[model samples]
Target chain A: MNPIRQDFPAFDGLARPLHFLDNAATSQICRPALEALVRFETDDRSNVKRGVYARAERASVAFDDARKAAMEFLNAPSPEEIVFTSGATLGLNTAAHILQERLQPGDVILVSLLEHHSNLVPWQLAAERRGASLRAIPVTDGGRLDLERLDELADRVRIVAVTHASNVTGAITDVARLRSFCDATGALLVLDGAQRAAHGPLDVQELGCDLYAFSGHKCFGPTGIGVLWGRYDLLDAAPPFLGGGEMIRRVSLERSTFAPPPHRYEAGTPPIGGAIALGAALEWSMAQDWDRLGAQERELAGRMLDGLASLPGCRIYGDTGTQQRIGVVSFELEDVHAHDVCQLLDSDHGVMLRGGHHCAQPLMERFDTVATVRASLAPYNDGADVDALLNGLEAVRRKLA
Target chain B: MNDALYDQAIIAEARSRTGAGRLDAPTVTAECDNPLCGDRITVDLAVQDGAISDLAHKTRGCLLTQASASLLARYAKGGDVAAAGELRAAIDAFLKGQEDERFAILTPVRNAKSRWDCVTLPFQALADALADLEKRG
Candidate 1:
């Protein structure tokens, strides 16, 4: 396997090099994907699906090819099943608006506490609009989704949107179990794959999700582009989210006929450069050896966790084992503000990490803390990064003492 | 980690409790907080002859916030209640660039001018608490 650090170019310019542990917020762009973005704008710039000229036709083909490649990347049933939106927020808002319209008043929408606010707020708006009952599937004490309670609540649920991995706690959920539960209840299952898509293998058919949404930027592609993979039948049945030029087949003063499936959801000029870059990113990701990447991160996380545990008053949250979690690890120090810890890491050790509620406010309330300092890893992160964070914390503790 | 932000003297002040301006002694102490950035301060003062006789503060957050509270505590001890209110305006004007020389004495609190809410958080709590104290007496 190629050295994972070689995949990213940003690290080459650093002096004494800083360790970046904020991948959950956004991953550093890979060199190949950045090149793809530049090539698209410089060499192949044209409006897609419209112009009959050679350049326009070529652009259209590139756009369609990227869509098809994304379909293959997600193992989606068809190219038409994917709808490109601005990002996961827009995709989820579209899903929520459509689902809310379909569900009658008094129907139930069951979400989980583990969901990001993007996933939770949209559904809450929908539930409030339709007078639907909203329920939260409890999380286990260890931070896993409580499947036992889910079985009991299944009958009342109309839609179940869950995070495949927790952003704060780094707890991985059992998607197959969730799928089975949703299937038995005849409820639609939507997976928030924003955190899982690049890190883990995903097959929509295998996961049994009716719809899945993930952002391109979080997976080393450019921002402002994301993909929503829905079963073709569901896409056909759901109402279009926005109306504009590209989404209609015919228009008249009186009435307009809408286009089919993916185009029906894509209303205006799409993010052509972003989609092309994302396709390149997916290509790079697929070529990687998962075993090496996962093992390296797991080993790095274990070393960090062990070092943190050895500290006098360090307290960690969620699952510690790599088998049950992702690369993101969160912890708090006794009598020290998380912000202080993050500042010290950056100033003293050149380690960049996130310290705040992480937009997981409910999780913070559940854990009974105002905030936590999180260190998330990418494939490029090595043992040195882990050492830097631990040593920085030790220095902080000594100075504070 | 920068000495300019958290100097040794500031750390020493934070660690010490004497004349820390803790309001626990006041019969009508007031505490205020800026929940967004976690800056907090409690004001302790004794009012006699319809004038401010004593004032002090216990503060935390950035240096500017602490320094602003320290400045307020010093001036408020002998000023009348109206004078204390007037000082808020002077500080607000100084923060807004109405008086440039006034800023020199308030340099430690200048960084928070852009982040006005943080710098004035302690003063806000003290003002409200003082109003409450006057109401009760």
Candidate 2:
């Protein structure tokens, strides 16, 4: 974690030793990303696509460069396939909206129990609006998608939307299985890539997904910026989600024509600086040695799982193994409430943890738990972070349970 | 930080489980959920005139929520709806860090602003119950 920790500002010069184990919520911004944000704001503070001056042209160039970076990071076929959004929530909403017209009554959108609310609700709205329906792919006790049941569930599924990686259980979905299902049924695949984006560069083409949505902040970029990538053919055929300046081809009193895919989706002025920063963040991520970082993450995750299981009355939700999972771990102590556990950890142990339904209420129900304490790891987190979390849980149990 | 927010007294109050049930025959009942954390409080009341003859609570939440439920029972068990009204003010004061002898155990909670709803959910259900009863009559 040495060189990785040095690049993140959150670990710098802390008065009290702070262990940030809440990276699933938002990772700390890296130096390059933050510098990119500042550079955009200070050096080129002008509107994109609508200005002629040098600063405006510079801003526009930087903005498009960021788009190219994102396109390359996701391994998207073209830069035009990338649409900058406010965050994953909005990106998913745009995905739903763009795909809405294709859905008709009796059509189904298959989502899994692993979804964050951002991934679940927008499709629900789309289903409801189109007189279509949503069917959840039941999660196994291990918290992975019960993909064995996919044969029965995919009959009416015009679209299969699911998480690339679960924020709660840390289980990575078996996308190959889903890819097969979608291919056989001709159901479009849409991935909520929020959690998986943090781990490494994505290959949407390789994953066999038509559209993908992910937040920048969770990938060491700024908030209020995210990316939605869709195939050119699908995007070209889709309706405009938002109608405004950059998104329109021409406007009249009664009728207005829309621009192409990405622009048609990104209405109004985009988060210029935020998008630039996210690109820088993606570039920074691509520059890292994922093989080394990934092993470090897995080792830390195993320790967290084993340590939590060792504690009396402690239960780890989802897969307890390091295989096919990210470093995000959610667990609970008997009798002690999740919020209380988190509060005590932060106040007493200086460990920052997130506790709640994790915006996946259905997943919580799947686990038959009220709330859970989640410790999500990033590249900068080390053994000490895992130690503090385990120690904090022990202290919390002694005090409360 | 020296004064632990989850001190002994608060723990005891939560452990007591005072008013931690449902009234079999209730004049009115209301449920409230702290949407942020999914902490829930269901309050049942037996009212005679404008007074709450008895009350019970089912709080499926954290320690602060349970402790607050217990405190709501302790102070407002036999009191009128107006007295329950005053308790809401007291909770507001406690949250504002103002001194209330009975609720002093929760003073430390003022600094933990995110947990404020946990301490207020029971009282909010009671308020809703009272308002619902009024609407019924």
Candidate 3:
């Protein structure tokens, strides 16, 4: 087994050697996160914010500690900046809702074609509600954002929200250029960090984004938990997204006052166990040697790219090189539908992959294809996983196409 | 696992491409997409006296979807306009584990739940065409 594979329980007892290449969808839970989840559920199970008894207090502390962990994981300025959300979808929605106050009529919400629908739809709704228009920074054939068009599209733009890294193409956005554009144009920057969070810890401060959103499930943690980190002043200024329980300072028959920053965003009882386990997952990621794991991932991704290229009629999307990209590789064999390839890969060879538009129909349109077979990699993935997919594709082509 | 899902019969059906192109002029045309996998299918029908006189389709989808479209063409060409809906319901019931020899080639697909939409896409387009024809007259 690969050394990193030992950390993932999904690899513990497999009927066959598992070739899990769909990390972009969700990474398997690490031992630390699973243990933390079980510990919270078994020992300190209680609703937070209202309960003051022993177990409840323990749960509250654990939840608070998890927030602090998330803050540290993002290199956020303060724990108050981290708001617990159900997932990145809810996080971006909250970000969009809060930022809706800033949008005026005739303003533009600048997004890119590389964004997953989670990042695009929220801004679109905000634009529609505020009587603002939506403009997109076009995608290059290489699948990277066309930053050259920023100056043209930056007019009257209030919020510039885009993916930190593409879920399908694995193309990392040039955030520094985008940040510069935001600074020059006086627009708020929001990053959908769902894909990048799976790679390693992030520095939202250094990235120069006003709001950052990421899902816990993609980062080796349980589902139903995620983080939305923003500057304290900005979060404090924006009105609460959801109105209930802990998010309010006081409730009356008529008007009610709201709580402070993080609490202002977290309504009703939050997913305490899921949040704590997400914190544990982040902490575990922090403890690892990312430089080493990243190098391994790059090599594996390179192998996948090269092997696919060797096969005739194989067309790959996004950057052909490993530079400025992660381990996610989307491609298709000529005359073969993506789902057919995926089905054969999984059923015959135990090689998992994702197919179809991957929630980025605009990008698919840009690529001029409806679907592609995607193989995403994580630190636990090894060369065997890549080879399994490469070998399986040949069989798929012979049998199907 | 390999032979079951993409059984030889299913593969041949998809490869057959029966009624694969769009009709030159059709009385009714309907288009639908598989929400799960983004498979798109367009069906053109020439209905006469509440029966299908001619049928053709353009499909951009997985093998299952292509095969399903082919099966629809083979089963319902020159049949009554209601055959599309009947076949759709039968396939739905078959996918839910009821026996129907017409759909036995698709038995392997029953275990793969995600592909259900792919297989049912063309039937939906045909039904949509029928509904549009009904609304027209």
Candidate 4:
């Protein structure tokens, strides 16, 4: 376990010593998960829960094992509660549609301003379909969710969908507290763990949310496979999201009966290969020494914050030095456009970072910035990455000055 | 990944640029923005007797894009309108990583085709402005 740069294969061949600071968008694939993907496609190529042959049976068993692995990853009560969709957006959309269909007109749906479009848009569409009211809990200048506002909206709020950590600001929202409030108000709580699940432990039981959604790709797994964990009773009560072969128990001209919890939510052909790879990714992440990784990333972020603070006209956004914050830090320099900075960093220094609104327009609107350059970190990133960024910023400053 | 790309000389040249090509008569100018990256470029040209006599640009983008904008400013200067169109064509070819037998005209832009748009933002902006000028004329 080389704590500095194990798990990822990209760090090996990088001559310029790639400083990947775009983990908020996507993670560099881990070797174990990549190997699992290759092995599954090359050696064990078969569709799960179909065909009666030995290969098919083996594939079925592998898929079932992956489900159980995902269950354990989220601390789900049962493997049956996990439903695999295309990704977090799809999972969130599925929950929104299903829940909205159940709601009558004038029902209230509450969401926070810090949500990613994946978390926000679904509820908007759902509210539109049901003619429901959509309320957003505001954020302070510091970017934390205003917990006091939640009490006002909780009484009428039917489904409270929020992100555990904001993608843009890296601000962590206390979903556990939200869940308690929602429980008292008799409102269903849905957590978007897409940004937080990769960095730390996630337990549905501990978090106590009625439903949770997360994507696999952000956690070093293959794309096109996302998890939707729901309470068994809630899932049992909801209507089927998609209809087809796997999700159907019986079909007739009169009426069709759907399968149990997980199966009912998962319709059509699932991302069998992706699910298996995700299971492998989860296993790899679980084996890591998180205390070391967390400390290293925080130290790196601290250095970045300090470096940016010393520069003239450099403004750091969001909660910089907050313990609950993720590895991402967004900032802007006066008279120096973020794209210009990112281009200089990438083409000249090979210091890859993201520069934009980071798909959280509401957060950007909150911060009053058109865009910010974000340098997000992963476990494999070291202090050198932060140093390279500082050097690149100096060059950018000199060029713009 | 070359230090030469970020060399102080290049940065200084980019920062302290005055103008491009021969001085001439009425010519069009244009600007563009990449909303995703927030890169911006403004191009100015002087066209006389249907030939480009002078070209200049002010830009805020990555080094690659600014470098390309500088090259475009040089190439667009002292060229006929037809030649400017030809330069655009050559640029399209260069962007696709295609070789134009007219290599000398494209020497300043060679090996930069991978990020051609970043470099040629000014050229495209000017081309569009010239098209509008022709429509008005």
Backbone clash numbers for all candidates listed? 0, 0, 0, 1
lDDT tens digits by residue: candidate 3, A147-184: 99889886798889999999988999999999999899
lDDT of 1 at B35: 66
Query: Predictions ranked by DockQ, top down?
Result: 3, 2, 4, 1
Measured against the true two-chain complex, the DockQ scores of the candidates, in the order shown, are: 0.23, 0.60, 0.71, 0.25
The per-residue C-alpha lDDT of model 1 at residue B44 equals: 79
TM-score for all models, in order of appearance: 0.85, 0.98, 0.98, 0.81
Please provide, for model 2 over A1-401, each residue's C-alpha lDDT reduced to its tens digit, 9 standing for 90 to 100: 45688888877888887799999999999999999999989999999988999999999999999999999999998999999999899989988988889998999999989899999999999999999999999999998999999998877899999999999999999999999999899999999999999999989999999899999999999999999999998889988887788899999999999998789988899999999999999999999999999999999999999999999999999889999999999999999999888888988888889999999999988898779999999999899989999998998899889
Write candidate 4's Cα lDDT for A1-401 as tens digits.
23546668877766668788899888888888888788778777788788689877877787888888889888898998999988899889988966886667888888988888899898998898888888899997767898877787665788899998888778888877797888787888898989887895578898888889899999889888889888888888888977787898999989899999899988887888898888888888877888888887788878888998898888888776748888888889886667667767887778998887777888887887767898888888888888899998998888775
Stretches off by above 4 angstroms in model 3 are B1-3
Worst 10 residues of 2 chain A by lDDT: A1-10
- Candidate 3 CAPRI grade: medium
**At residue B131, what lDDT does model 3 achieve?**
80
Query: What shift in Å separates residue A304 of candidate 4 from its native position after superposition?
Result: 2.2
What is the DockQ of the complex in model 2?
0.60
**What's the candidate order when arranged by decreasing TM-score?**
3, 2, 1, 4
Backbone clash pairs for candidate 1 read: none
Give a tens-digit lDDT track for model 1, residues A1-401: 22666778777656687588888888888888888888879877989987999878877887888788788889998999989988888888877866776677888888887888888999999998888877888887677788888877765688988887888888888988888888788899888888887585578999888888998888888899999888888888877789897899899999888999899999999999899888888888878888888898789989988998898888898877778788888898776667657766776788888876777667777787666889998888888889999998998877664
lDDT (C-alpha) at residue A14 in model 2:
80
- Among residues 3 or more apart in sequence or in different chains, the pairs in candidate 4 whose N, CA or C atoms overlap within 3 Å are B22-B53
